[model samples]
Target: MDEIIDFESLKLHTAAGYIRASNRCFTCKAKRQHCDYKYPVCSNCAKNNTDCMAWAKGSKSPIPRSIACYLEKRVAQLELEAHRLRTELNPEHLDDKENIAANLSSKPFSGVCNSEKDDIGDESFGFLYFRSSNLPAPFDCTLHSSDRGNIRTFMARNPMVDIYSIPSKIADIILQNYLDIHLPQYPIVSSEYVRELKSSVFEKRNTCGPYEKAVMGIILAMSTATLSYKGEKGALASSGALFSYFLSQILQVEWSDKLKKLQILLLVAHYAFSNPYAADSCYAMKEALRISVEMGLHKELDFDHISPLIMQTRRRLFMVCMNMARHVFSVNKRMFPIPSELISFQLPEAVDDHYITDSGIDLSGPPTKAAAIHFYRFRLYETEIYDVLWGHKSIKCGLKEWVQKMSNNLDSWLSEANHFSTINQLKYRAICHASGHVRLYSRSPRKQWRNREDALLLMESVIKCLDEYLVNASTGWLAYLMAGVFHVEELTVCLLDIMWNESNWIFDHYSQAYISTQVIQCIGLLQQFSLRWPDIEKSKMVSYLSNLHLKITSQLEHGFVIDPHIISQLNFLIFPQVSTGYGLDSLPEDTVDLDHNFIQMQQWNDNFTSSLSIL
Candidate 1:
């Protein structure tokens, strides 16, 4: 080497010097300051140990490079001493012995680098360390060392597994923890923030199929609406508006056409009763023919699988639609009249012809089929004609005259409903219409009626039909709607007066034996209203209240033995009164209040049941 670079000098000048340790034990020789040790090994042993060993071995050992110069000087000195001794003793053998020693003392060859092997081992140890990955990142994210350390420990212990391998134990813990924390804060996962969380998780997992995701998104949106609408009126309207926003988002992001169409139809059907405005979605929903054509889609959405609770919700939703439409129709009919020629006959003749046949009219007669041609036709056309006739005097007069003449001829068909069987059909259809009307009608008061007289007539006919239809009726949803209609007026009064009033005698004999959970809840709430009724009304209205008290007492006593109806339940516990719990942070603090009414309600019911038991 031009400069004869030393290992010591190189170590001192290197960039790695900052990280170097100068620890010397029994091997490489360096000075006190250079050696990283509490007690330094002396320079003789550290620097020349290899050469000293080689010299001591004479002809048997080879010199090491680290001390080669020092070893060579020593070897020369020894050879001189040997030559002098040989001259004193036997000079002849000296040359041969010295040559033999020179031949034996050759330098040993060394491998490239012994230290590199140790570096590789250390690197492998670091690469395998768990803390180097998940733990270190989280730790570095935090400013405080202690905080970082704690979080690092947590993450190290709870590494995220692949979504497919989500253990039941982990899932349970996560669900409980999530519910315990977020249920109160979020209340509804459909909120923008929570949905973002769901979306983020979904993306990261990459586990959900496109169709599944689309279905899941729709389910999430609908569930949010359903939960929110529980205690509110105009539930469909409120839900429909929210769903439209969900639809807007889904339409843009979700590309699976089949799922997209099915989801749209569901949204439409879901809101159909509540928001006729949702009918505007028909522009998109006509694609339902293509979207939901698969048999699997029907299986996934079977009416048979619909729960009692959902059935009730749907029936109520339908009732709202029908009632709203019927009320609107009644109003339009009262306001105006259109000419007979202008009315469209949309009902099929077979269906139209049945009404006339039932009305005891022959289709052969020129006068008209009394049921189909006169009453049914009149009923359908009257509203539209009246709408047209509102501004025109001549049309109004002519419409009025026509309506009167039509009414006279229609008496026979209209009166046909006076028959028991016919009355039942009319009542059934009217209730169905009432249910549907509740969805479409606007809230503005324009002399609207609940059609109390017609409702009372329907209720009377239902009671008459009950014994015959009881078993069959429970299977269908119509009875639930009928129950809802009967209870709506009572519900209004109970809310206004803050007390329950006894329903008429028909309810007493109706029996809870065939009652569905929806019916039971309606009864339970009404019963609760009676117990919580105003104290002022209690003493003064004792005679009026007697029936309610007796009815409740008798039912509670006999409910197990006679009716055994399972009451529809509300999960009040999930939505609690506590602050700093799930979903509560998002709720206004002032809105939290204690419910003491139910305690008294339960007490009263228990007392009444006990007294009845004694009797």
Candidate 2:
């Protein structure tokens, strides 16, 4: 027993005159060997000249605390490296889409999922884009079987929708509304064709196709809902009430023709732009996007075998789908999925639907509804601008030279036929003109602006759009609906930056004079548009524009330079909200047009600016 005890004591002796350490290197832990109790560098690591890092796994709490902590940190490092490798390996990532070595200047249109995101100590989670474009589900087979647990599609139905067989007198009102309001905005469906068809359909309600009835009901509902002004009940509720009746008729219809179904959905989505009333509008817009893509509307396809009328309708409908989808995603603040480059479809011929037949198209007649031809052309050009800006994968799009070139391209298109010889011609031309300038105005706030003269032109263009709306109140509402009012607020904020914040491109006395005059005219024009379209008064966009126009113009009038801190305060007024839009689209008749809350804030800015010395 004494000999055994002495042998155990000799075997348990501490190495190198050190007590047993509570920690061990990963190599010793793995090899099942004892580690030297040493600091800075363990005796085993020093002797072998190896790393003293720890990487161990244990379910029991008997493992050394140092090894456990080191393993925890090592696991985190491995996770970070894994994430980086995943990001680098992801070909669909916007950064690596072009080539392995290529560097893109434009940020990924938005953020990415955890695997692709840059690591910042763990927390990364978001949407993942797995396709090059908005292709159909049939084309995108990358999703795992387990990932696609279920599918939820929005479908509206109402059996009682047949009750809205509008009387002839009401039919007359609805038809005129289509001609005056709907035609200018869409112009895809022919007014004469629809008018004659509605009469025939109403007469033969028992015999006509469900698609025809559905089409007629949707158009009439959209027109009437647009023309009707609900005072305090909110435009959304009023439009929702109006749409509930028509939608029931729509959903109950047996839709066999896929193209017809797409057209009806586009119509509903278009109405949502003017009055985003219900969820169906948003769903209809999304479905339209999907159907148009699957049907190959965005891609060039051989359609010579199709009928002439059907061909033209396809072209017009696809254009409406592109523009309408953009507005939907933009307002909802979702990253738009449909890439601009995928659009290769040709514009429809400039002629009436009556002139087209099963054999071919003829543009010889005096067609009154050719406004859509021009609108489609504009949308095509807009797509070109988007693509051209993003054409060079390595370049930034906010450059002034590129913007000026694009703006010139638009002007050249409008310069082809500027004469407002007809109401249809005038309405579309003004819309295209204002839309082009607004596009320029949108780019003004990025980095360094182009020039004050260009800024002045953009401001005049906005005012000019409002002027047209006022001049042709009957159909001028088309211009009001085309571009909307969000950009106006954003552009005014740019104007404030140029006039005071930057202090570099300071407007000359003459420039200041015209800017102030145009600024006031812009507000005045909006106030006038407010009388007809209450959204002009109800939007925080217009409120910010009005108040900023007041404050910024005063600084110009009184010759005051803005302070940095004050500029920040004014800029904070917009923030994340301006990107989506402002307040309610429509307001009560008794609702005060002015933003009284903003007025008090502007008064505060006025006082602060008042104390500053003149330049």
Best by TM-score: 2
Q: Please give the RMSD to the true structure for each candidate, in Å.
A: 37.2, 20.5
Q: For residues 293-353, could you state the per-residue lDDT of candidate 1 as single tens digits? A: 2212211223466553333222222222222222233322222111223222222122112
Q: What C-alpha root-mean-square deviation, in Å, does candidate 2 show against the real structure?
A: 20.5
Clash numbers, per candidate: 38, 0
Instruction: State the lDDT of candidate 2 residue by residue for 526-553, as single tens digits.
Output: 4554443433333444554566557666
TM-score, model 2 to reference: 0.54
- Give each model a TM-score: 0.21, 0.54
**Poorest 10 consecutive residues by lDDT, candidate 1:** 119-128
